[model samples]
Target: MNYGMVFLSIISNRFFDLLDVLNKLNELKLFTLFINIKEILLDLRIPKSKQMRTLEQWFEEYAVSHQNPKNKAIHYVCVPAIFFSIVGLLMSIPSGFIANTLKLNAPIIENWAVVVLLFVLVFYIRLSVAMAIKIAIFSAICLVANYYIGQVFPLWIFSIGVFVIAWIGQFYGHNIEGKKPSFLKDLQFLMIGPAWVVENLFSKK
Candidate 1:
């Protein structure tokens, strides 16, 4: 009898036996369940890559109702419209008193819109840095547009009119989608809506 070959055969048999038991457990669908239970009972740490990926997935999932082609197209136009209208409306408001008090009188681009955009960017930055930067650039364009809109027309009146019309388009889009807006469930989705729109310009990878 060759002792080394005998020991190797014994080890191979034990390995095959373990694999057989695992295969049987897998057929019963208990292998994963048992491991999960074991982890829970033992308070073991499970890796979190799946959850990390799902966090990004929430943006697309939350925007599911807007997936309809017409609805999405409408959002592409209306979300920015509603956003810039609000910014214009706010910029039209006289923050001159606050500016005077704080001595922040830069005369252009330092107004209620700038103040509000600062706070809004905080919310976006917490979600994604790239998104926050995109929003800032968008806000800058809106500021310039606000100046132009104010130059050509009554800023508040024009902004309010656009705001109302843009929102009407939004509800109409949702009507086409056969679902309510996600912001109705949680207002954070209001911010996520813009992020979803901006992120579409980039690839999934």
Candidate 2:
């Protein structure tokens, strides 16, 4: 008898719940961090290209060269290791010039790895907001781990070792798959590789 009123009440409650979440993000000063490329495109009045692809499209293309079970298993380990090693190498670079030029002094923000991660985050944000958030969390962990590991060993040397070893593992995996790595065809696939791994891992759960 009062179906219309019940529907309105449910909608009202959901609207307020969303507002509460937004407020929490604001309180944490992370509201801006969650922005995506669609918002940026809209702000600049730019239209998406007809040829532009979605995240899943990139994943599909990447999967074409990674079909073997052995290759997939190797990627499960090496892709992340390569990413972490790259970040570690960047972290090892001196950031005094960058910090001085920007007049910024915070240890975290002054890091070369942290600076590069911002651009990396933007790349993921263009693909998907959820993916970007996942990557951002993982990037933070890499920074923390590199900081501690550096105190015990030379960061650049350690990063170089990991990088070389991980690539060796990757080449071995591709030999099993009998196909060239996708990144050889398109350099952007290097970025797609990590996102593809993260997307598959999360989808399994």
Candidate 3:
């Protein structure tokens, strides 16, 4: 007769024990979730400050000396004009074999600018993919502009004049800056200059 009461008591005790275990498990799960979230936030905060800066950093570094208002003003025109002139100079080379191979109706389509600028684009891409894309687009426009300019006048002669004059202006700006141009030390600065200009312009706005 007493067996039934004892059996009920045993069942009640086991139920309470199970409830206690479940509560502890729930508390443990909440604590673990909190720890994971805290760790994730810490990871996000830490790596960014420690990681190396991107190509943009290099641009800003080069820009230090160029901060002189006179120098900054000169670069706004000279950098792009120099780039365009280089494209024009390359285009001035006689089409030769390239003219016949593609047989495109537009002479400019298969001209030296496209061939030469491809390598330049790869150079830019190696530095920074996003900047490279922007430069590639701008270079394509310059090539098309060169094609038209070539139609009206002596292209190579004009480009050389532009290149020399622009460079003179650049050096004059640097003199005012009282710091040497970055390109003076490393030729890579030549490629980086245009991107630096583009990034600076956007950052200014």
Where model 3 places Cα greater than 4 Å from the true spot, the runs are: 1-53, 203-205
Candidate 2 regions with alpha-carbon error over 4 angstroms? 1-51, 101-106
Flag the better candidate by lDDT, 1 or 2.
2
Model 1, range 1-205, lDDT digits (tens) per residue?
A: 9999999999999999999998998899997888889879766443354234342775766767778999998988888888989999889988877688678556457688888999999877766787899899989999998888798899999999999999999999999999999888756577777777777755375
Judged by TM-score relative to the true structure, which candidate is superior, 2 or 3? 2
- Reference-based lDDT, residue 182, model 2: 94
Model 3 backbone overlap count:
0
Q: Which residue runs of candidate 1 sit more than 4 Å off their true CA positions? A: 1-55, 102-105, 202-205
Indicate whether candidate 1 or candidate 2 has the larger TM-score.
Answer: 2
Per-candidate RMSD, Å: 16.0, 16.5, 15.8
Winner by TM-score between candidate 3 and candidate 1: 3
TM-score (C-alpha, index-matched) for candidate 2: 0.72
Q: Write out the backbone clash pairs for model 2.
A: none
What TM-score does candidate 1 get on C-alpha atoms?
A: 0.69
Would you list the rank order by TM-score, best first?
A: 2, 3, 1
Per-candidate TM-score against the hidden true structure: 0.69, 0.72, 0.70
The local lDDT score (0 to 100) that residue 166 gets in candidate 3 is 98
Worst 10 residues of 1 by lDDT: 46-55
lDDT-based ranking: 2, 3, 1
